[model samples]
Target: MKLNLILFFFCTLVTISWAQSPNLSKYNEEIKKIEDTVKYFEVEKINDQFYMLIGGGGNVGVFVSDKNVIMVDNKYEIIEEVLMSSLREITSNPIKYIINTHYHHDHSDGNRAFGKMGVPIISHENAKVRMQKVTQLYGGIYDFIDGFVQDKYPTEALPIITYNSKLTLSEDGEDIEMYNFGSGHTDGDSIIYFKNANIMHTGDAFVRYGYPYVDLNNGGSIKGIIEVLGSIASLANDQTVIMPGHGNLSTKQDVLDLKKSLMNLYQKTVLGLEKGLSYQEIADSIDETLAADPVMPGAELTKLNYIKSIELELNN
Candidate 1:
């Protein structure tokens, strides 16, 4: 009887440990898949010192300095070595800081690799908290039709530095400002602006991808996104270059265009609600021109998901 009791306690402890630890096997498999797609990756020079790495995951903004490099978003894990190689092609400075625009795996999964190298990771406090545990991602047009589970990140992969609304890092005579404009794509989205370079890296907050995705399950709302976009447009000037979370380099005009599109959608959604239209009815009523907007490639489903998000926001 005592032997059985001891075994039971031991098994219980093991179960608890397994629950606490990140799924290393799953993490490794994901890394392997990302590495296999390295051929799609390309690095584009934005200016004298800043470069944009595209393909694989979210766009990465690389700010090369005389002594060190500051990365706005560090794609995936295995992709870090590839990113480092790409940086070496540009400059020999070591990566000194990693700033996560948000806690999404595509944008910040490389945090584990960089964190392991003792590179300090900075993000919004909410992002740090979200990264520390398993997260559910919803509102995708396809793969996330139901929802997707993002496993918890290991301790070393988590952000070491966190801020509430704003934080500034002065490096190489530049004041890099990171600002969280409340909840939009996620509760912790950060829009980073490089003062000297006049370049802004608007994480998932602004994407070139057709139809914006609002992660309602993760404190995201279309209304919030519209508000955030307005703020970003106001902060940007005609000369400012924008490095979107998942697209080619953009300009302030592009930001305004996206903002205008979102605003139009918000107004339409509000009008539909006022008319007592169901979410499906509103989605179906979106005209071809609006649904076929270049930003929303997956027209029908994307419209549905977007309308659903707006409805959820309004009802709440």
Candidate 2:
């Protein structure tokens, strides 16, 4: 009986270890290969409000106010303690609200963590649906969708509040306007604007480096991203700071340059579409005339991926 009990205990430990390996591994690749040597949560001051960039599956925005703390996206469950503790380095105020840019795992996995703190979590109605699927597939512990699915099963981290079109939030004297950026990065991608701070947090909807990934399968569109970015150009200006889905913090001119690149790609693809070119023909053949503009280093892969996504979009 004693031997059986010991074996059971050992097995339980192994199971727990195996279950946790995935969550930790999620950031392993990101942390291991950062060429910029940029640690997560590089702190910066914008209009007196401190903003921290928490880069994981995507980048998260930590907006510190005088009275309350507002978070854009939760990093991951494994890092919830770390992310929160890091926040403590800046302010001890409890996280008042968290907005899910979309339903992707890297952004929403921390929902359970913040939920435990009793903070109200909100997202687009579509974002909630996507997260439910990620939760079921990963068993609620990890974010990788394939190959690790068997090892990283996790529970669904659902959102408490969901908005369809737009939601305006006023908390502790800060004005945050969450606007759906159409079907750019995702069907429910939202642009979180801090009115007082003159900061706009563009989720995966606006990644700074590489060719942007438009998850067309999940209602993303390359053309849509271009249109959305065009609109955001008006929403921002020379003094406005832009928080992207990934990469470093940037400015309105930086965001504008990004839009121009996508627009160039779209115009190329549209011309190909007019010619009735097949997806492969355009993806492999369309000229990247705008590739040199944004000039994000190590984004050669992204350019190809952008071309391929455009081709796929035309086919669809």
**How many pairs collide in each candidate, listed in order?**
4, 8
Best by lDDT: 1
Error of 2 at 177 (Å): 0.5
Writing each residue's lDDT as its tens digit, candidate 1 over 1-316 gives 9999999999999999988864455445656777886754587997789999888789999998889999998988867778778778888988889999999888998897889999999999999999988877763443343445677779998888999988999998999999999999889999999987899999999988767666777787678888898888888888999998887789988877877877776778789889999877776665642344343355666777677667767788
Clashing pairs in 1: 210-295, 210-296, 211-295, 211-296
RMSD of 1: 3.0
Task: List model 2 lDDT by residue over 1-316, tens digit each.
Answer: 9999999999999999877654445344543444234344555555456575554456778887777888988766666656766677778877778998887656766776777667888888887766655222321111122222212213435677888878999987878998886888778888888887788888877775556656666777778988888877788888888888887788878777878877776777677668887645655564553342243433444555566566667777
For residue 199, give model 2's deviation from the true position in Å.
Answer: 0.9
lDDT of 1 at 185: 89
Instruction: Identify the runs in model 1 with alpha carbons over 4 angstroms from their true place.
Output: 1-32, 140-145, 288-297
CA lDDT scores, all candidates in order: 0.82, 0.69
- Which residue pairs show collisions in model 2? 138-152, 138-153, 138-154, 139-153, 139-154, 139-155, 140-154, 140-155
- Predicted candidate 2, C-alpha RMSD: 7.0
lDDT of 1: 0.82
